[model samples]
Target: MKLLLLKTLLQRRARDEGFTLPMVIALGFVMILLGMTNIVKSSEENLNAITQNSSSDALAVAEVGITKYRELLNQNRILTIYNDDQWNTNANVTGQACNDLTTTPTGWEDGGTATAPNDTTKWWELREDTDGDGTDELIGEYRLVSYQYDIDDDDFDSSTPPTNNNGQFSPSDDNANTTDDFTFNDVTYDPLGVIGTSNSPEGYNPTGILTVQGRSTDGSEAQIKVEIPLRINQNDLENLDPALWIGSTDTTYLANLNGNLGSLTVTDGNVVIIDAASAGSSGCSDPADGASYTVISDAREVPSISSIASKRTEAVNAGINNSIPVTSPAVLGKTDDDPYVTPPSGATFDEDIHCANISDCRYYYDLSATDITAVTETDGIAKVTLYVDGNLNINQDLGSNVSSSYLEIYVTNSGSITIDSDSTNTINALIHAPESQLTVNGTGTVKINGSVWVDKFVNNATVEIEPDTTRISSLNTAPSYKLYSTATARTPRPLTGSPTNWVREEVQ
Candidate 1:
């Protein structure tokens, strides 16, 4: 009986051992499955990280393209005037970079076409030497998808509209209505017209918008829209506040003028009547009622002297450093004893400083001696900019022929500026002497055809001043002041929290 029990137990043990092998096999299989699952997940995570990195890179590349394009545009800007309005690159410009709109900087592809995205040639490869070993590694590529201008619909003249044929706005041929819909790259772009004239400084309206696509080597893409707004040219006198800007706040009868004020039918045209004190013995007449000139004693109208000085400094730095030494002979007899000429010493003035041949004609003076630096533009001169560090005396006619078209005088001292020329002389020049007092006491019927911005002004001379809008319009120079809109402030991107004004988005 005991032997039979042992056999039965052995059989049961054999069955139990067989069941253990199957369980172990099942466990091993389960472990293998988990390992495979983890491997797959790791691969997926790596791929996702790579894709995210590429997208980030593409976004950075898109921003870089915006900056690069802006730099190119600024460098290749060509503005044409139409009806006394500044039509920037977006307007009618011929034979220039803005002519075709397809022309780009050197090494940049011409992808301004409508199907720029499909064209592989339009891509500009972005490269950087990560190790700084000269051999640049390809980061990604970018393409200018579309460039369209936001025209001023209100400003468009239906009678004399500007033409835009094949992205070429011809100033010579005025045909196409600027407000009409223009097709570019198979897309009819609508005119995102200006806000208003009051908002625009000096009629500077918004230019246009640029769309660029940035693509990474991994096929990731990012698109950004960059708005190009109108930039204020500092040289353009239109940016100036008033025709005659007085920086002083002394309300003690500062003006004593009897000169006639007249304008060339400009926005703010008028004559002078500084009868607040007395016209003295000057033979000047006052303007009729409803004149165009402005008369405000508000201290808020005062412009900072530093701002005007900066403009003068900018011109000097831009290769206009022609020095007028003290030794230079003056047309008027220089009385060394009477450096401070309260009134004319009756000196015979017969000198003629002609600046017709020179282009810049910016003459600078650094005179330690208080001698009068007399200038008389007998011959028609180009845009002559004089930077006087001491006293300046204008005899005879000052830029009679050119008027305010090409004459600008910037005085940087408290010295006297004597206008001893007779009244027949037309002093057509823009004078900016914030620190000095301008004394207009010539005997002749002097006609001031330009603008004057001085600290203290004494109008004892019988004169006729017409605020020349041409003064600001004729000034076409560099070192401009870029006035951005409330939308885009000095940058292509929009301000935080004010996303409605400007549009910047990642389309891809």
Candidate 2:
């Protein structure tokens, strides 16, 4: 009986052993599968991290390109060979190359050819020290391509290919269509809305679209495009603040014992007097009326004579010396009879004069003689910046009308100015003579519709000297022609506002 029981037990134990062996093998296979799945997940995570890093690097390189372009504009180096009129030719790139920056622009190519001159090499390579060692590692590269953003169509893909082989990307680009192409087509834009009237779009040049293609070492690429518009610098005329500025600190009576005869109405500015502030300090009938100006003792110090003279010197250097010998009844600027007057000597008064209109405008005038009977801009509107070495005498009105003409008389050398116009007539001018005196001597009411900056002002006649808002606004219209070069005139608009004026976008 014992032998039979032992045999049965041995068979059962063998069966149990077979089942356990199969279970062990199955557990080993399941463990191997889980290890393989973990390995695959780790590989995918590493690949995703690498892709994300490349994308980030490409975007950083593209932003660097935009920064480089902005730096060029800030340096005022954009219009060295171009103007606002031919803004299309001033594009950073031409044709489809603007969108497809892999094919470089005309002026910026690899090993630049005759048709493409790479003055500033092609790629901006990015280098980094990945391992924190002394040597820098090459990370990525980027290139810049720009297009002219015309406000008329409001699109970015309208650039045409360059036509000429000059490789300068200039007037010969679009069949030599070098006319004033910056004017908008039926678009209404009110800048600042100060005048209430829709101003002419002469100074508001068209915008530019700058695209940057950034590539990482791992073949990852990205594109970024931004709008670069032209903007007027706010502090372009920082010196000309007060409407009527007196530089004299000497005790001079503004009123000649007659309680100050005429009126001096100021608008949109102050009447700063460096002299002692007393009752009737401004010498006006109503100093606090429609004119809200102050008469502080130390409001502002007078500008030096040399500083004012340097401005005249700068204008002379800029080929603005449209000079003539002052004679009685001699017209200085353009007239209806001779609208396009090319002077016999000195600089030529052509369409490039610094003014609102682009016709034959004469901005700088170096009058040889001192006396003058009449000065007028008979042809349309003109702005004159007259430099008088000797004493100036105005026997008649300086400008024709307030709206049509403007004048800035500079008498840097110690000289005086005598305004002897009729009471009914008006003298519209900005007189700046820090080392001289101004005498308004007329029996009738002579109105001066501009500002005055002199050492001393002697009002012997009935005169009203104040600056109107219209004239003040004209000083800011075209700042390239301003008397003070306080700041650069035109610059790329700041990255503000909506996508229309200035914006940034990522390209697919």
Candidate 1 Cα errors over 4 Å, as ranges: 1-17, 77-91, 95-103, 106-121, 135-137, 151-207, 228-508
Candidate 2's error at 21, in angstroms?
2.2
The digit string of per-residue lDDT tens for model 2 on 1-508 reads: 9777545544646548766556658867999999999999999999999999988888787776666555543322233223222333434322211111222332222433322212223566667689998887777876655433333224454356422211121211111112333332222345544332345354233445556777788878788776665433334233334566766544334333222424445554555554232333233212232334444332224554322222223334332222222221233343211112233557533333443352323344555445433443332245444667777777655563543224667786777777775556666766778888878776777766666778777776666655644522332443222233111112211221222433345654
Residue 502, model 2, lDDT: 33
The lDDT for every candidate, in the order shown, is: 0.45, 0.47
> After superposing candidate 2, which stretches have Cα over 4 Å from the reference?
1-18, 76-121, 127-139, 157-205, 217-219, 232-508
Clashing pairs in 1: 237-472, 261-270, 261-271, 269-292, 269-293, 270-293, 422-444, 423-444, 423-445, 423-446
Candidate 1, after superposition: displacement of residue 273 in Å?
40
Candidate 2: Cα lDDT at 444:
74
Q: Which digits, one per residue and each the tens of the lDDT, describe model 1 over residues 1-508? A: 9778545545646448766557658867999999999999999999999988988888888877776665544433332121112222233432321122333344454334332122324777777788989997878888766554444422222355343322322222112223323212122223343333334322233344566788887888998875565432322223333456555433342422322322222234332222221112122122233344555321122222221211223223232112332223221121111111222466432213322333323233333334445676533433344556778887766763544645556677676788875547767776767677877775666677666767766666665666654322222421111110000111111111111123346663
- Write down the worst ten-residue block by lDDT for model 1: 484-493
